[model samples]
Target chain A: MRFSALRVFREALTGHKGWTPTWRDPDPQPSYDIIIVGGGGHGLAAAYYLAKEFRRARIAVLERGWIGGGNVGRNTTIIRSNYLLDGNQPFYEFSMKLWEGLEQDFNYNAMVSQRGILNLFHTDAQRDAYTRRGNAMILHGADAELLDREQVRAMYPFLNFDHARFPIKGGLLQRRGGTARHDAVAWGYARGADEHGVDIIQNCAVTGFRIRNGRVLGVETTRGYIGALKVGIAVAGNSSTVMAMAGLRLPIESHVLQAFVTEGLKPVIDGVMTFGAGHFYVSQSDKGGLVFGGDIDGYNSYAQRGNLPVIEDVAEGGMALMPMIGRARLLRTWGGIMDMSMDGSPFIDRTPVEGLYFNGGWCYGGFKATPASGYCFAHLIARDEPHPTAVAYRLDRFRRGAMIDEKGQGAQPNLH
Target chain B: MLIPHPILGLRDAQEFTYLGDAALIDRPDGLANPEAFHDYLYLRDNPAGIHRELWFHEQGDRSWIVVTRNTVTHEILGAVLAQDVARARGRSR
Candidate 1:
């Protein structure tokens, strides 16, 4: 049912029993024309675009658990297109555009807040680097502004600007970049896809793939043997394990990255802010909690929990940047597994296996890339061609030495 | 987490720096087989269970060691020096 002000008023006047389930809890069909593994934000968005844009029929999204149980619900919720490389900048910019129109298109309240994002610099070299990055962002048709130290100070006076060692020098601001309600994004996409007749099957774990000769035929699941003419794998951290079922190994490693939220307080942070000297980035949520996170746990792990050393390191970084945050009691913390690729970029290309496709290796950027990742993945799956902006995210780029190493960290997933 | 250092008893995980899979130690001859080198550099058997990984004791003895740990449960099974493993693999120079 379409929700509106009139509908809400009518429902409020009545017993408010007009509300129904947002998305249907459908059982898996005997087969589908296309099946997408892992019903996270990306997979749901892919299914949405496949049905709505590509007008494809008989689409199914299989999830081990319920929707939004994965990285979509586990991210810091920040979104931006301020990337340095050509292979990444345009694609993320497209995603930013998608985010701007997402709520209205999906008819859901996703809370796409474009309050802006600032990357603070600490030194002259850092300023120069940010200047270059800002130019790269502008070149990609995304908004960017170089703010002086006084401007940053005016924006966030609570920041430790007078730190003797790493004083705040300047910052690069993206006026259109900010956070979104992450779970709402997943729900909105799932509902939109369901409206378009896509089956979202939850509590169904894919055990293995049925491959014959050199092509994939179907999948073996806990539910039963489900047949599919085409299959696309969008599992983020489990990309290696799932693709291994198809006898394929990836240049990806799973690492746990942790995030924290402090107790509710009056609104303080206006926009997302990142520390140049460290990996800490924080933003104030609508509910007044300060959500922040830092570097990964720096180890290979499939577990969704992190150790203490990284927690201490993140807290130290937070203290170094904003001493006022020390008074805030940390309410809760959680970890999400990252599919760190060798070159630190994602892939939206076909695999060597016929009738099987892959869309993963998102590292720390998957949350921001949700819209474009799904849209481009759907385009590739339907047209059998790479999206123009995602042409560089090929699986063989590492072997060809055409790596898109955003940080220039070569072949190291942990460093990426 | 604590890594039972082969020579220094149990050591806090903070003393060591992680370098990922132990398969990295087997450096392929790029000149002889570039394809093998490509696979060695980019691909991985990223298992969810037991994983033998490389870690450097940068804060302790500056020694490289391999730690057999479960990636799923974060359980450390064993640890050994990288030099000893390399020698056992018949790398003598």
Candidate 2:
């Protein structure tokens, strides 16, 4: 029948493995100006930057699946730069600026709601740590406010602030940290980049890189054998795999994180709130649904589906914060793979190989840092220099012990 | 919150009544004797004398306890096994 809808249905049911590209008498192009692998947010943003900012035409953004099909559409949609890490400070703070101007830049309504975010403290030590973080944020020119019991009570009166029991001592409030629409971010960047004459290639898988003497010349894809003067690797955790094809390895770990949203209610949660004593955070979406998330599943899995323990743990935290959430049923839950770096940050810089660049690893905070990531990564690739914002996030900082280490956790998934 | 009896090694679980520091910091004799919140009795915090102290049902595990303290310095001496304090409460019963 050759129906487009029927083709999509059949392809989806077949695990999407069969949908790999095919080269039947593939045509050969002389060379593309630039080739971007993995058309996720980072890749799409890279294409946009290279085209719009650098004025580089003949660029291609190749995706193995549909657009907005990867982590771009799979994150918890939480945006905040309230980190205690060293390198992350400038990087994410810069992202906050990009987020502020995104509406006009992309001409797309990203639904960036600045509902504020509060990290609750349960004990004296925790309070002291968050207070230090808040002060540090202020010193770094980011807005982080410390709130006391009375302040918290006045802010959210529905809280069970049994001062004697779970003593609602205080919290760290990041005024600039909030949520944004994830899909819209993808679409906005995509439409903007595509408008600049960047070829948005979907359903095309780059099978291997055609490297000559440790330098990438082009990529061999099932769609066709296309040569590019430069190649950019923006794939998240699968970064190591692609780089390995070019005979290189990066410090990247692929881990799974899950997010859950309850059925719509009458705007109970005004802002995002995270508990220090427990692993839970909750925020209300624009649709009146309480979107909540918790710690990663504490294990390495290619499986992008979350297990039961963390969900229960997060639900319990939501109930503890606002007992009223117990009445709202959990509507849907999903998971995404995160490329966790050793320092819980990202690396956006050119590679040792000529004409090759890599951008991956933002850990759990990638959603909030999207704009900054794209802009900074683009500067690195376009200008052929270390980005001013991500200069500390070089590939060699891990060896120098100059890691951001915001949570004081080590460079491991479980520790982070 | 302070329990009138020991819990860990004592006879039985003496219940704990949750209250603030202002209600139970000045005297311990009031706890030994029946009194009201406005009776103006609180933890003694005495050094040489047996002191009364407050504890909380944190985590809601419900382990009864009695805290001893130095009345002069406000230093907590020890929170003993409340079994004996529970026995005292049972004997009074």
Q: Number of the top candidate by DockQ?
A: 1
**Lowest summed lDDT window (length 10), candidate 2 chain A:** A20-29
C-alpha displacement of A86 in model 1, angstroms?
A: 0.4
Task: Give candidate 1 misplaced runs (Cα > 4 Å).
Answer: none
TM-score of 2: 0.74
Residue range A210-278, candidate 2, lDDT tens digits: 878867789988787889888888888466556777766565555668899888888767888986767
For model 1, report DockQ. 0.91
Please write out the lDDT profile of model 1 over residues A17-41, one tens digit for every residue: 9899999988888999999999999
Q: Count of backbone clashes for each model? A: 0, 17
Model 2: how far is A172 from its true place, Å?
1.6
